[model samples]
Structure formats: structure tokens, C-alpha cells
Target: MTATSISPKSSPDRLSLSELEAYIRTIDTSEYTKTRNYIGGSTQLSEYISRGMISLPRIRELVLEKNSFSASFKFLNELAWREYWQLTWTAIGDDIFDYIRPIKDTVRPAMPEAVINAHTGIVALDAGIRQLQTTGFIDNHMRMWLAGLVCQVAKCDWKVGAAWMHSYLIDGDYASNHLSWQWVAGSYTGKPYLPQQDNINTYTESLQKDTYLDQGYGEIASMEIPEILLETVDVLPAHEATLPEDTVTLDGLNELKNADTILLYSPWTLDPLWRKQDKAIRVLLIDPDVFSNGRFSQQVIDSIVWFAGQVADLKIICEPVKNLEVLTAAIIRKSYPGITTWPGIVDEPEMLFPEVPVAFYPSFSSYWKQIKKYSMTDQQSLF
Candidate 1:
């Protein structure tokens, strides 16, 4: 499909890698940790990072170049958390949807209707949900609060809530999204994250009180599921778009048929500069199965299509990677559990601590300790 086919309405703000870098340079990390808990206090660079328009290594390098590590450590830590989740996902695979550890409390099998309808009576949370539905964006703190409300207070299954959230998120990554939900559900962490009314008030700047969340931690732990959250609702499955019948032919496919390398760009790896010097067939493969299961919104799909347009001679393929086995060799950026058919080269994500162990670390503290050991001594690289 042509880039012109993707309507601007279906895409979020479209920024090229250079434009994204300019935006990144403008981020003020001085007060990030102190103000990040409040809505609109974040850098809002997640969509670019998640979509691979900007890499983690580049972000870390850029931030460090502008500010001292001490000043930007919190922001860098946040970037590292994304890497930690990805490494954890690589270790566990599909098991991330299941409980990593036994849950201590009851969890409803289905999602609550109140959450789906955005009428949970929690003003800050409902506002966040509405923002998510409209713009496919939400701050991290609101995300935790929403997750806590859905998986802990609402008592819904974490997977169910996670899938609902993933459907609309422009920055949704299975590892980060699912694992965070599990963390809130007490499946990945030692305890479920329960946000009290005061906590919400402090972060959201709302004077809301007397809600079900307005209670002591002990009282909240012992409280029964609110009547509003007692009933479950069926979340309508995300609509899948029809793929093009024929893949677009690249300009050099015939001449490069005998070439030893082919760069494959999936939704996860749309890097414009990947293997630019090599004479290879560059294909943007969009597997129907991947999108079907991913349930990505039209906006996210549009953004992907737009990003793929940036690369010269990049052919868009609608079928699975397995169909392209005729290619001499394939190279791709490592992604989720699936998308592994004939991987000639799997490039690891550019991480701050590339040498850190990949085994699942139960807590970010455990993972961060290992990261700090290497990040402190490593020389920084700029994009």
C-alpha cells in the first residue's frame, strides 16, 4: 500500500527521526523524578521509542550529552525499565500473560463493565481512560493507577485488562504493557499495587475523596470489591484491517535476488538507517497474524505505514516472513515471542547495559543495580 493511503486522521503526530531527536533535546530531565508522577509532566517520547523511530541507546546518549548522569539518572532509569521488561519477556515468552508468581488474592476472570465504559466514578481514572481512547496516550502514573484499579480494586484478570489497554495504546509493547499489568496484579511483584485516594490526589492534583479508593492501605486491602466493579463486561475485540492482496515490489528486488542479505523491517524495526550501505532487498513485512493478535489501533497502523515510507526502496509486504524464505538471508531487530521464522541475524536492542543478564529480575531494583554497575563506567555514544 502507498503512504498516501494512510489518512492523517488515523495517525498521531508524525515525527521523523531527526525531528524526534530535536524533541528529545528539548526534554528537561532536571525535575523529571519529582514531577513525573503528575499528569502531563512526562517527556511524552514513548510513542517514538516504542515504534523504533528512536532507539533507547540514542535517547540515553542524547540525555547524557545535555545533562550530567546524576541529573538525568531518573529519566535514564525510566528508559532502562523498558529494556528490563523486554529482557524479562525474552526469558518468559508467552508466560508473561500468565502469573509469574502465585497471586495472593481473588481476581475476576473478566474485565469490569465500569472500566470498559469509563464510568468507574474515579474522576482522574475516567479522565485518563477517555484520553487514552481519544489520543492513544496516557502518562505512566495514570497507567499505574488505572492498572491498579482494574486488576487490584476492580478484581479483573490482568490479561483481560492488559489486552483492553493494548488495543488503543500507540506506544504499546507486549512486554512492557503485559508485565506492568502483571506487576499491578501481584503476579509479577510481591504485592498488588493499590493507589489510595490521597495518592491519586497528590499525583492528579484533584481534591477527590470519599471514593472506594479513599482508605488506608490496610483497609483497602481488606475492602470488598465495589458494586460498580462487581459486574463484568465483554470487551469487543479489536477490528482487524484487510491486508493488501499483493505485496508492493521494490525497485531492486530482481537485481538483489541473489544478494546475500535482506533487511526485514517489521512494526518493531522501522529504523531508516538499518543496513543502508548494503545492497539488499529492504522489505517492510506486515504479517496479518501479527496484527490480528497485536490488535493495534488504526492510528498505530497508520503511524507504522507512515514510518515505513521514510526509507528508500522499502517494499511493503502483507504476508508472513516465512513466505519470503527465497531471500538469501534475513536480518531483523529482536521483537516479541512471535515473528521468528528464518532469522539470519537478530540484532539486540541498543541498551545502556548490553552485557546485563537476561534472566527475569523480580524487581526493577535488582535489575537497576546491574545496570548501574555498567552504565557508570561505559562511555556514551551520540546519534
Candidate 2:
């Protein structure tokens, strides 16, 4: 789910808390339970939530201020699914990138050339690929269809397609993106997700029929990879996206001698309002290790820069974790995916439900059952 095109109520390139706040006030989540499965039916908040622009807690605080808990239950559950992946990542670091809880018939798959070229015989899938490449977004259902086409049909390792998709996503979070691919491939959830052509047409409103996917569940489940999808090309993750040294505008970073405190930001933790009142050196620190198994698109990096600009005097530091240096002055960062162990005060990421699973659970249904117990109350939303 390291995720849009609804763009909410403002420009996707630039958004503020005030703008997002206004958007949730009027958003109708009551219909989300029924429509979110459609290509354009989602509320379009994944990009915002993944990048720390907004959080589950903040969303609940805002949405509940206007809408009832029942009205937003389905919406909240969707958000919980995102959190579930993240929590799983926290429990088992880096391992989420691999195929786990396997079903059967997994292979070391590569990117199908037809998929990369957006020439897949499936009209909806081809368009989804183009949209993902061009705009850095595709609906979750579209994403599922694409994942199924690649993993189940092509029978490649889920990591290959997962890494490819993460590299281009504006909201790519490794935990969500990789684990989700495994879910579709049946390695994570123990059941392959084979979305038939009829399902795709119904959700995306595309009418083309007689494609390879145009078959019943039983027939499609047993079908082999179509000839069109047999040709594949290995996709290496773009070497950790970086801004050129000449383009790096920040200076005086190698030595932070005079700095009292450094408030850090990462690709995963770009909360503009975090520590806003504190008089500290705001830093958007790019630690390469933060990109687990895959990297963010350049557009995503640009979004990071834009959000940093919102914070007063925030500077950029592009260094791998191993080569990083922050001597003398104290440093602090939000406890994010990769920057968790950095030598400084690291704050735990804010959570909607602070009650995390004591033991790892392979499925969301299991994880949610444990978390559902620690609700604000049974009658209230556990957001």
C-alpha cells in the first residue's frame, strides 16, 4: 500500500495540514464500505498517511469531529490494514521483503515486458501500469489486478514486482508494498488472489472481453500464464534515489558544532508539524538504509523536499546511515523504518492504536482481533 489520483481537495504536489483537515471534514466515509473496492472509489488518503503528512490518530480526531464512528468504520479498517503491515515490519524487520507463509508454485519471477511497457493485452491493467508510471498512483484494486497478473499469472517471486512497484510509487512504504505483493501471490495470506477479467471490468469500468483473464474463478485459477505475459525483464531497484551534490542546497552539515538539537525527517516520516514549536535544526535526513529492498521515485523525493520546506529552516542531508556523522550536537529523529537505531533521541512513530500485538501474526484478521480488544471502547471507533 506504499501508495492516488483523486488528489483530495488540493494539488497533489503541495498540500498542507490545513488543506487535509478541511478535506476530511466533508469527506463521506459512509459509502466507503461499498465503493472503496472500485478503481476510483477510495478516499485517496494513502499517499498522505504513508508519508506522515497525516496519521490514523489525526484522521480519526478530525473525521470523528464531524462523522460518527460507525460512519467511518470501514474507512478506519482500511487504515488499520495499512498499519498492520507496518506493525508486522516492526515485529520482524526486513524479513517482510521475502515470500512467507507460502501457498504453492512460487518462482523467482521478473517483470513482464508487456507490463513494463503497458502493452499488456488486458486494457485495464495496461492503463493502470501507465498511470502508475506517469502519475505515481493507481487504485488499490487496479494494483491488485496488476499484482495478480505479475505474480500469479507470471509466477515470479513477489519481491521482484514488489520492488519494481515501490521504486515508482509516490507513497512507497516497503512494509505495505512488499507484504501486499506477497498477499496477492498467496505467499503471505496462503491463498493466491486471482482477479478475473469480469471483476476488473466491473471495478474499472472497462468493457473489453475475451482476454486471457476472461474466465470463471475455477478456470482462471488453473490457467497458465498467457503468452503475452511470458516475456519478462529483470528489474533492479533504482539505486537509492539521490539528489545530486550540486543540487543539495544545505551547507554546514558535516559539522553541527553550534546546533543545540537536530530534529530529523525521513522519507517515511515527513510530518511538517512535528516539533514545530521547538527551536531546533529541522533536518530531512536521507539515510539510504531507510529504503528497504526498494526506493522511492524522484517525484516522491521532490515531495519530501516540498514538505520539508513547510517547516521553518529545515535542511536536507543526503547520506547513507553508515557514512552519516552528527557529532557534538544532539540529534533526534522519529523512530522510522531504517532510522530507528540512529544515535539520538528517537521517538516512536505515533499510532492510531497504541496496543500492538505481543506476538507476530501472519494475517491481518488475526492481528486485528488482538488490536480490536484495546479499543477506545466497544461503542466507539478504534481508530
Candidate 3:
């Protein structure tokens, strides 16, 4: 998305420490349940949640305050999907970057040029790409459709398309971003997700027709890529997703050398109030080596810095985790291209199911059923 489109509804909203709690109080899940599947429907809060400005526990608490578990299940189910992906990442380790399941029907294996240019002839897909590039935001349904178009319809490799989309998303969490694309590409599920023409028009209201997408659900598996969509840019794996070198001038971190404890935060773990009571030095460790797995736009970088700023007395540094270890006995950070690995702490990143079983979850519904037994996680009691 572009600078002009960076609104709260589209991109992640920055809230000062005081404004955020108030923001949480006003969240309503009613409309999310009613129309979240539409292209314009549930854009309200995923970006915020994705960036860790808000937590699912807090959201679930708010939803439960007004409705029962069953009444709020749909919205909570959506939240669970995010947790499911993260848990899958934890369970599978670096496997999320690889195709979990392979398909025999893919005709092409690179990202389309039209998606990068935002000129796909399909009205809904083109608009979504524009919104993603311009606003760092697009609804989830659109994301799935775009992924389906690239991987299923256009026959591009999901790895290529996923890396391409991850670069532009403001809410670019690797587990969520890559895994969701895997889901659409039939690599992470039993069948590839192909959107029918009516499905696109019904939710997107584009009402356009006579393209390759204008087919019944049953015929979509064999549909040819449209001529306009046939032109594509070769991705590194999808084509080549270049991870930028970790090169930000580090804020002075030498000053904190004598501190008793270090509460390290990678981009994956930035929150203002985390461990606030623990007397420790908070450092926003910008380990390019770890976070360099996907390409990000300036807007994504800006959102991250904005989020990091919310933490009080946070030290910003640009270095590999190993370098920091040499700087002091301070904790080290080491992340590879797409997988985030922090050697300093054994603590897991936030997830509804923080510990994933060693076995792979064949589907989210199964993961949800097993985790739901205790993952409902009555977060209000913690208050």
C-alpha cells in the first residue's frame, strides 16, 4: 500500500500507551461475525493483532464479555486460525517455507507480473493488490483469492507468490503470511483452493465476467491462466525474494552493558507493556539476519518502528544475534532467511497453543478441536 492509504482501517493504527486500552474497550465483534468473508468486511483489527499491539486473549475477553463462546465462535475462530498457523510454524520448525504437500497440477511456478504491477484485469484481484501496495492492508478474503489465483489458477508456486505478498503486508508475520499461502496452494491442505467466478463477484461485488475465473467450481481445477495473467515475474524460489542486508545504524547499546537483566525483543515480539514489572533493560533487537526472510516495503518498516517506540526506554540495535553475544554476555539473536530463531531465550512466541505437538496437524479444524479443549484460555481471569 502507498503512504496516502495508510489509515487505521487499512494499515496498523499506532496508539500511544494511554490510547490503546481505550481502543481495546471499544472493539466490537458483531459486524465481524455478520460479514467478515466479504472483501470489505472484517478489516478492522487483524493488522493490530498481527503486530502484537493487541492480543487475542484481550480480544477474546472483550468478545466474551458481550457474547457466549458459541455466539463469538466465528470471530474467535478467525483468531484461532492465526494461532494455528503460528503453532504449525513452531511444530514444523523451518518446514513452513517448504511446500508441506505437493500437487501435480501446477502449470507455472512464478509470481505473475500483473500482481506486482497491480494491473490484473480481474477487478477484485487488481484492486486488492493496489490496496496491499498502497495501504499495507487488504482483507483476508482478498489475500486468499490472490494467493489462489497465483498458485491454483495461474499455476505459480505458492512459495513464490507468498514471498511476494509478504513483502507488501504491514502485518507481515512469517508464520501467518507463508502458512496461509500454503493453505491456498494445496501444499498445506488436502485440496487447492480455487475461487469460482460467482464466489469472487458475490463477495467482491465486481460483477465482471468472461475471464478464466468465470467457471463453475468443478471446472476451475482445469482452467487455463488468462493471457493477461500469463505474463509473470520470476520469483527467487517463487522468483528471488531478496532479503535486505541488516544495515540500520544501531542506537547506542553499549550503554546497557552493565544492566542486570536483558529483556530482548525481536520484530516478532514488540509490545509496550510486555514484562513491564520485571526490572530489566528492554531492547528492540533489529536482527536483519533473523528478520530478513521476506522483503518489506517502507510502510511495513515504519509500522514496526512505530510499534517499537511504544516500549519505554527501548534500545534499538542493528546487528546479528551473535554480534550482540560478543558485545556482552547479553542474549544473542539468530534468525535465518524466513524462519525467526532467537538463541537467547527458550520462551516461545505468543500462541493460543504455545506448545505444538510433534506431529503435524493435517488441518486447522483438527488443530482447533484439540486446542479448543483448553485454548479458549479465559483471559479475563488473568485480570
List, in order, the clash count of every candidate structure: 0, 3, 15
lDDT of 1 by residue, 1-383 (tens): 22112212223457766777887787778878789889989988887777776788888777766787677867887887888888888776788888899886777778888887889999999999899887788999898988988887877888899988988888878888999998888888777898789999998999998999999988887788999988897655554544433534454445346656667777767777776787866777787667755477775676567777666677666665566666655455445444555465776567656777778788998886766565554533211
> lDDT scores for all predictions?
0.75, 0.74, 0.68
| lDDT (10s digit) by residue, model 2, range 188-307 | 878889878999999988898998899998887888878997888876535355552324223364334467887867766778778878887666666645543345666666556565
**For this target, which candidate reaches the highest TM-score against the unseen true structure?**
2
Model 3 Cα shift for residue 254 (angstroms): 2.9
Q: Tell me how candidate 2 scores on lDDT.
A: 0.74
Off by over 4 Å in 2: 1-13, 237-251, 288-296
What lDDT score goes with residue 378 in model 2?
A: 75
lDDT of 3: 0.68
TM-score of each: 0.87, 0.90, 0.84
Please give the RMSD of candidate 2 to the true structure: 4.8
TM-score result, candidate 1: 0.87
Which regions of candidate 3 deviate over 4 angstroms?
1-13, 235-253, 290-294, 329-340, 348-359, 372-383
Candidate 3 per-residue lDDT, tens place, 1-383, comes to 00010112222455664566566555466766778888778745765666666676766766577665665667777877877776777677788898887777744767788878877778888888889888788888898999988887778888888887887787887888898888888878767788777898999877899877888877877756777788887753222233322333223334455566677766666666677787776666666654455556766777676776666776666567665555354553322223244556544444545444635687987885666554555643212
